[model samples]
Target: MFASVFVIALGLCYCSRASSQSSLGLPRLFGPSEALVKTAIEMNCELLTFPEDEPILLQLFREGNHSRLFAEYTSLEGEVADLPVYVQPYHEGNLECVARAQNNSLIEPTVSNIHYLKVIEPVKGAEIEVRSGSVDLFEGNMLELRCKLKAGNHVSYKWLLNGRLVSQSLLHDDRLLINRTTSQDSGSYRCVASNSFNQTDFFTSNSTEVVITVREPVKGAEIEVRSGSVDLFEGNMLELRCKLKAGNHVSYKWLLNGQLVSQSLLHDDRLLINRTTSQDSGSYRCVASNSFNQTDFFTSNSTEVVITVREPVKGAEIEVRSGSVDLFEGNMLELRCKLKAGNHVSYKWLLNGQLVSQSLLHDDRLLINRTTSQDSGSYRCVASNSFNQTDFFTSNSTEVVITVRDLVSTPNISFTVLKEDFQNYSAVVTCRSTRGTPPVTFSLYNSTEVIASVTVEEQFATFKVPLILGQDLGFLQCQARNGDNATYSEKIPLEVVPVGGPVKMPYTYDSGENYDVIGVTFYCKAEKGTHPRYQWFLNGTLLDDRGSFYYVDHQPPEMAMLMLSVGDSSAGTYHCEVSDSFDNTTAISSRRLYLDKHTLNRLPVWVVAVVFGSFTFLILLVSVCCGLGVVFRRRHYGEKSLLDFEMERMTPVYYGKLDLSHYNEDTDVVNAARWGEVDQASLDSVDEWPQIEEEKKTLEDEPAEEP
Candidate 1:
């Protein structure tokens, strides 16, 4: 029995050791498997491994009723290793765990890491509420309410009305909205908020009510006048009154021709016109206003008025029948007068400022009975009305003269040509008397002197003389006489032409293209004679001077002609004008020069080509130069080379130079050499000293070059 017991105990110890070595809660190395280790206590532990096998060992102890352990192992290569593990209660009970490694030694459990787990209590009462217990909302108005927690988590909100959940899913937003609403949508509202950790429900609210109204006003008032039209004679008095329909305690105003008229008392609704005249005719209206409002006013149609007065009438004017007269015995003469204006007027005839006939009437007809040379005097008329009187008389002088023809003479008349050798022209000869009664005798004299005689009825007269080419152009004189006296006229000279100078042409062709030759510019010279006149003709139709010329043709290299008759004053050169009526004209001389066709077509072509070719060449040259510049620049510098050169040359160089004199001193030289050698070795001993010396010299030389 002792032998058997020893074997069992040994077996039990072996099983505990094997179990600690193989137990790891690290799950399986491959495939899905649950490799869980059940321990009697909770513990912290991690698996750590290195490139080589090292044995892990641990130590354990207890402080203040808690147990802890630190474990370490050393490999055969002298490398130290550690394994940490911890043991504590798994739930509310005490526990124990052991750690073991692949080297087959038991390890005391050590605490390496700790973790905590927490538990919370469940939620309590949660709810939501509006500001008032029952919310009364207007249909179109915005609804704003807050949901709060009486207990539990900060809650969320929803809304409900009439025990059926109103759709407040969209009320996730803070505000509830209803737009363009009608009267039916007003109701109660509520919200709720909650969370998983709490219990209890919360609520809040108040009631809302609303009403609406509509708008409008009364109708318009009316106004009327009492009297219609007021017409009054000049200097007469007139009055008018106005009235209103729906009359009330109101104010009244008077108006004339639609304009308000002022009076001592405007409150009375009456208009009075005093001392009325033709100027008083107009349409009249009135207006009435009250504290409530004013009535619209309109006037009657206009009225017409007429006025009358009396005026005076006046009589006639008188004058003699002739300019001058000679007083002689038994001469028949008469004086007369006539009326001018006005009605019911009469006249009394007056002679030499005295009344002659009292029976003259307003008809103004008057006459002298008979006349002798002594009856010559001023005559006039006296005009009168029953209401007014006046006198209109001729001037206080006579306008008559007379002569008595007692004896008469047979007058001698003759004509002489002033110039000798009258050729193809006519002349005028005059016959006159120096002293004679009207009706004197005149006679004509030629080579035989006194060849014809005639009775002269006036003091002087003229007769035409026909010239015989050679003999009639000579000095000529006239003889004139009355029955009592005779006299001779001064001599006049006569001239005649040689019958044929160039026959005058009388048309001016204005300068133009159609009249480009000589014939168009020809004009006639005047014939030197009396009553010389001008006439223009184009192909035998008489042309007016004001509008005769026109451009019959505008083609160049053509000759045109016009016809004319010359007057005495038109004796100068005339030019032909040819034009296109664009006010573009070629003078007679210019048209002749330009009619050569060789010049017109070639001139414009040469000018246009020269101008256009110059512009095209200028544009092409500019484009070619710009393209060449871009190409040359790209070929000279590639992208990488351009960037490197910019970095090298464009960076600024500093001029911080060390003083050689200070370095040459003993102490500074020792210190500088030490640091310099160290820096040189660090920079791989590049030749930075030469570059620094060159930059120092450049900076030192810059100031000397400035002057």
Candidate 2:
């Protein structure tokens, strides 16, 4: 077993040496490496290793050729490593080479797939062409074009019009078709192609130009005028119109100096005019255009217009004329005025240049009745029209002045007394001139002397005259004057009378009294002179003449028989005034009569004495009885018989034959009878009374007187 082990070891060494030589060293180490190294070798190559003591080598080969040694090398550090081999042809005639090392390491060569390289020629010329060759086309026509590329693969193609790229069919296919071209479709055309290598190419045919043309406009178009120039008066109407070419599809526009006048489309083209005037004149034009490829234009020229108007004329005039030669004061006068023109006329009566009445506009004549100085001013007329106004004045019209004469018409004078008679009294005399201008003066004449005068500013005048005792009575007159026109009212005559003395009384009378000597009538008369008429007043009322004297048949019981009551009205002034036929007056005398109360109360003395004596007797009787009663009573007591006898003896004897001749006849008979009877009784009782008294004394002691 040990011998076998030695042999095994030796064999191993020998194999190792051979493997190393073949793989790592010279060409002969591997058996003639002749092969064509083709890259088409299966699955490429592999690597190998050499033994420890071996060296390394490389071989070159071709497909179907002998392999040749290319290089050799010793293994570093006595070790072997594989190196790669290569083949040239990738697929066909597969060739390969291997490198070996002394250590018996080997490696197969790497191979590559073969790619063929082709050199392409640059593009020589390109062309873009439309189907029709030229680009002149109508609107809505079809257009087709193509771009041809000379050489290249994987090339991109783009079509262009007017320098802008357009869509094409596919990559490198340069054809463009545009259907229904319009005006916007006109332009030049070109194309471009590009490849993956970023290589670019451009081709432009001689510029293909297309233009879209519009159709011409048709005939039968219309023209319109808007707000045409016109000369219109203040109250006139204006109209405008549109003119047309008169065909189908025709429309109109109204323009004012090239601006659209209204928003409404005008179908009818005519306008109307009414109430024409001068202001409706100016230039007017019309425009006509259509949709059929025609140009629009205004009318060749404008038209001009003119107008004229007129105004109204003519009016009226009036004149006034007066008739009458002389105008008398207080006389009615007449004046006439007439409109002269024949046109529409109006009449107005004017005083002092102002319209007087609401007269109508149709009257031709005017009459003024009862004319006065107020109607004497200038008179004229006014004429008017639509165009002018004029006023015409009368030519120097005559003015009439009234004349007033002193005709001595009766004066209407009213007189009033302001105070009672014989007092300071005033008289108001109003004298009026019924037909005079103004400035009337009134004169009041008392007989020959003028008492008062007054001037008046108006035709009527009033005169105030103061009258006192002994003033004269006269006539009064009022005269009026205006320039030369003088007039006088009639004279007024006044009569003055004196107030009378108080009434005297023969208030009582007996039938047997002497009528002539006793004068039973009392005289009472108003103091009178000249024209003064006597009027007796009783109790303030005038007394008419029943007789020459006012007689009282009997006296009043309580009042004096003849007495006069006097007041301030008595003993007034008196004047005698004589007036001629013209009422001129003259005065002759003036007197005033005043009487005292005693003289007026004188009457018969017997009656008075009787009444007075009776009254005295009565007074004395009453006094003596009242005062001497006591004294007489004492005396009679002391000397009663003596006094009685003496009184009895002294008592006068009375006889029944007492004569009536002893009594005054004027004395009342009844009173005389009473006295006579009383005396007679005393005489008859004188003797018997004492005897009877003595006897009675003898019986007195016996209580009754004996008879």
| Best by the lDDT measure | 2
Q: Write the per-residue lDDT of candidate 1 for residues 384-422, one digit (tens) a residue.
A: 543323221211122222333422323334433333232
**Estimated TM-score per prediction?**
0.21, 0.20
Per-residue lDDT of model 2, residues 268-332, tens digit only: 55444433333334344444443433344323222322222222122333332434434434444
In order, candidate lDDTs are 0.37, 0.39
* Model 1 lDDT, full chain set: 0.37
Candidate 1 runs further than 4 Å off: 1-437, 440-451, 456-466, 470-472, 479-490, 503-523, 526-535, 539-707
